[model samples]
Target: MRRMTPARRILLLVAACVFLACTAVPAWRGAKIAYHLHTARYLLGQGELAQALSWLAYPLQEQPRSAEVHYLLGNTYRRQGNFDRALRHLAKARQYGWRREEVDLQVVLIDVQRGDVEAADPLLDRAAVHAVPDDVAVEVYEALAKGYLALHRIEDAMVVLDTWIQWQPRAVQPRLWRARIHERENDWDRAAAEYRQILSVKPDDVPALLGMAGALLARNEPVQALPYFRRCTELAPDPTQAQLGLAQCLRRLGRGAEAGQLIARLLRGSLTLEQQATAHYELGLLALADHRLHAAIRHLQTAVDLAPQHIALRDALAEALEKAGKSRQAASHRQQAERLRQQEDRISRLLAALAESPHNPDLRCDAGDALMQGGYPREAVRWYMNALKIDPEHRRAHESLARYYEAIDMPDLAAEHRQHATQAGAQPQLSKPDQPDGLRGDGPPPTPKACGPVQDQPPLQKLEQRAGPP
Candidate 1:
């Protein structure tokens, strides 16, 4: 080798220095990204989604080429239910390099929720063939199972849950999910077995207890269900369902006195129309068994009037009506029962919606209307009260509540509700005088009267108008 020139040596040294400078920048950039990502992950776990999004935005902007950054952004967006943003980021993640099974699984969840099963299947298949960390695998499997279940793809959901349980046998959620699938299929024995397995792991799991009790009851083993129902009532924040089930079991076991106590407790609380009807039906059955024909008829009539879709209760009521020597009334009730069948699905959907959005006053008020229409005045009042609890100044809730009170013969209470309605910004009926339209330059506003479908009553003319604007 010949000796190198000084100029060439200097050039080689400068080139080496430039290369290191370029390399060091990426390392420094990566460190900053890792810091933001760590904070974002912590925030995400704490359910501070907005904060997580803010922290994630930094890494996403600073390190676009980082696959982990894109994947995390996609995960966070998906968890926040922003499916479009999620898919955008997830697609970027896939485009930058290769497929991430967990990311693909999350994208598939969005597709499943969007009801694009065709789009979801290929991603799911890809995810199935990839290996992931166990923790990540658990989360992806759960998301897939829930997505499939929501779309009513029962067999797919069952397969996912089954696979998850096989890997982690003591996992409470998958067992509970498997139990629900069995319950939905009406395989009561299998559902009960799954619930028992879950209970063996997490003894105080309220959902499992409720499921087990329901399954046992469906199998006509009330004696075995009673303890589960009783324990469920004790553990639940809203004990109405468990209490009702416990009462039913007690009734079946010929412990009418204990059942009666539970039913009486339930009637005194806030109950939905179905719950109210169930309570009344049980009481009617107990009354019938005691040969108190008139009492039985009254309760059975109340139950049938409130929930005519309950064929079993209607059957009992029709029998009681016939036993009272009124075949014509029995026939009419049977006809009403037939007409009621289709309405149950709508009501059940509304009820389910309310359960998910219990704070929505509009939904609560609509539920009240449905119940009032179904002839459960008392239950309707409870739903109205629930609406008021969520939004004390809700105009429609107050108006409907006023009319309900008026119908129930509580005129004073009705008038008080009219006062609330007016205060809550309900417009008084356009004055009959019609001095032009809307908010006159006249001396004073018209007196507020009760709104909704109610008979005309004396207006609250003496009250002051504190409601400032339209």
Candidate 2:
């Protein structure tokens, strides 16, 4: 490496500066986005989510069609726990043709939290198929499984659980739930197997132990159940529950005296209202088996009193009274249970109102979500578009439209609308995030197509790929 002369060095330096000057516009534009990213990250690190908004704002107005800007916006809102805003920006990021898997997972999480599991399923499925990180994939599956369980969609819950178990073989919660679901479905052998698998790993897991014991009792193998019930009692912090299980097993085995002692002790312990009712109900059952008619009637009455809303408790009390020759009281208890059942389902009422308000943008957005969940993308798109026709800035509908467009192979349109959604959200104004209304409204209305009326029209050809948000 020979040292260059001063004249030669000066000429080379000039050449380098000239080259940089020639590329100045693109460099400045790239630097602008880089500055936003670096500043946003620093603010985020300092727990100043609000402060970070201004940094991204400049870039967003400059590159409304930029997937990266919307992506930053989505994550910023996500950290703020503003799922609605987060989802809106995430959708734009996806539409801009970036990180569809990552964005879908976020959408699924938001939908699950909103109790719209139906809206989350397809996106969750897509995320599961993609190569997302293990933690996100697990969260996606668990959220869907738990959501389906809450809605009484048992089979759907099981399907997700199966996949979740496959992916996270060491996850204890899913396996426990899988076993519990099996128990509910009366698949005793499968239930036992799953519980045993959990026990195999976490030998002292109390829930699995209790569940396994209960399953054995359901199979009428009291002899097998007796030991497990005893072990659970030994492991339990509140051994009062163990006492009740022991009593049940002893009574089943025809050991009346020992079972009666256990039940009596259980009734004297500190217990929840439900537990008090359970203890009384079991004593009533054992007393009836021993032909103590008056004792059975008294205990059954106490159980019914403690748990007036429990149909089974009411039924058991009614039966004990009938056996004790009090048919009138049994009929009254039945009538009370009937009245409780007769109360209206409030969910049905909200659903009815939603059904009737088909044109309401919020309702239409919900309808669109449901349609999307049910695998009707085109119809969902129509509803989402219609929703925007009513309110162009409706964040969810725009986000949903971006998803629809992406699913149908229209990446360019997806990115455009997704970017549109970022601007459409309810983010706080931080240092003039956008240009004045004059510039914001520069784009013309796009032609209405299958996606419905345009919310923000397609930007002009020149602006579509501009440095700022179009």
Candidate 3:
């Protein structure tokens, strides 16, 4: 109990100080980590992604083993659009045995954003195969579906989306994805059904409403789709696309003035060059539908000027100019279109002539090509039929007829052709006359003269009816 030796006292003092320092170190580090984590989260909430990233960096350095820090950092990076860094941190989070499913999903999403779908495929596969929680499993499936969609593997996307929907019927995402896939496949009825299912689940879902409107418009059911389009307009943040879609639906439903007003509003907004051109083009078409040729010409000309590369807009402008009696401008556009059309026609005719010879099974399919190129799609049906008649198993002909019928709004006929094509083991064919040579050569020739608008027939005269009326 008396005074200790100097060396012993020094050693004892150092030992006590060391114990205190060791104890304080963890608390200090823990506090620092907590503070940084909270600050990072706050910055993220405020959308200050860069600031959040800086805050997350310190915590990550201090607690290199911390999974939560890695995950938060990944999220911050993702928000900042630094997909590579986001992926690196997310992968680390998974490696550290963090929320494996959530980190895996972030990795998949980043891969998709970076267009590394092939890389994402294995991660998605692993996530699906693993014993993940239900909510996490749904997320993995959704991510896989999105990955497939990004790669344009639509059927694959549908398979994933359908699986998710079966597991969670109440989930709107799966239905929304299913609708998107259907829309891409031009299966408007199926797309509309899926969209309706989403709406039933989430009545206020703007995307579902917009999708429903689009599907209805595609099916020529604009009248029925109007309410959904209006709802989409009401719920959308910017409401530009919804408003544009509404305008289209209204125009299709013969509500020209209402459509015009919506188009006018869209035009007044700060739109991208492409959007501006599209808006002008749509307004022109609306004007044309209303028989306001001068106004149509004005909007169409502006559209053409804005987007000279848009062949459809240019063609529309020419048509409007012709209706407005601007013969010179119309003639110029017609000349351009004719030049392009002639180039296509030459190839089609050559193919047709070769096919007409009957010697080359490949060339015989050309008759469909010629019919389509010559703007005699209805006649193209005959050529395709004749080709199929010669080679009862001609796949190209069936595929072509299916596409032509679809274009002409004859879904039943199109389905029949598609069935025949599928039976013949042929790929789907496009309705365009200038399709790839592979499409013409590989499958049955397309239907001949299948898509032209029907001319209104003259009213029948009834002498007996006239006498009765008198």
lDDT of 1 by residue, 9-123 (tens): 9999999999999999999888888899999887765445677889988887777787777777887787666888888888888888746666667766676544333344454
CA shift of 75, model 1, Å: 9.5
Q: Deviation in angstroms for 337 in model 3? A: 5.9
The 0-to-1 C-alpha lDDT of every candidate, in the order given, reads 0.72, 0.69, 0.67
**Model 2: CA > 4 A from native:** 1-114, 118-132, 309-311, 334-470
Per-residue lDDT tens digits for candidate 2, residues 81-150, read 5778898899889989978766765666665643355465455344333444444545555566655554
Clashes (candidate 2): 12
Q: Which prediction has the highest lDDT against the true structure?
A: 1
Which model, 1 or 2, shows the larger lDDT?
A: 1
Tens-place lDDT per residue, model 3, 1-470, is 78899999999999999999999999998998899899988766544567787888788788898888888888777645577788788888888888776776676666554324345545544533344444344434544565544333344455556555655677787787778766755789998899888878878877788888888888888788888878877877668887787888877777878888888888877887877887888899988887889888889888878876566887998888887778898889878777667756665465435423432334545755765765667656755765554455678888888888889899999998888878778544333332323445654532211001112211111111111000
How many clashes in each candidate? 0, 12, 24
What TM-score does structure 1 among the candidates reach? Answer: 0.50
Question: Lowest lDDT 10-mer window, candidate 3?
Answer: 461-470
Candidate 2's displacement at residue 187, Å, is 4.0
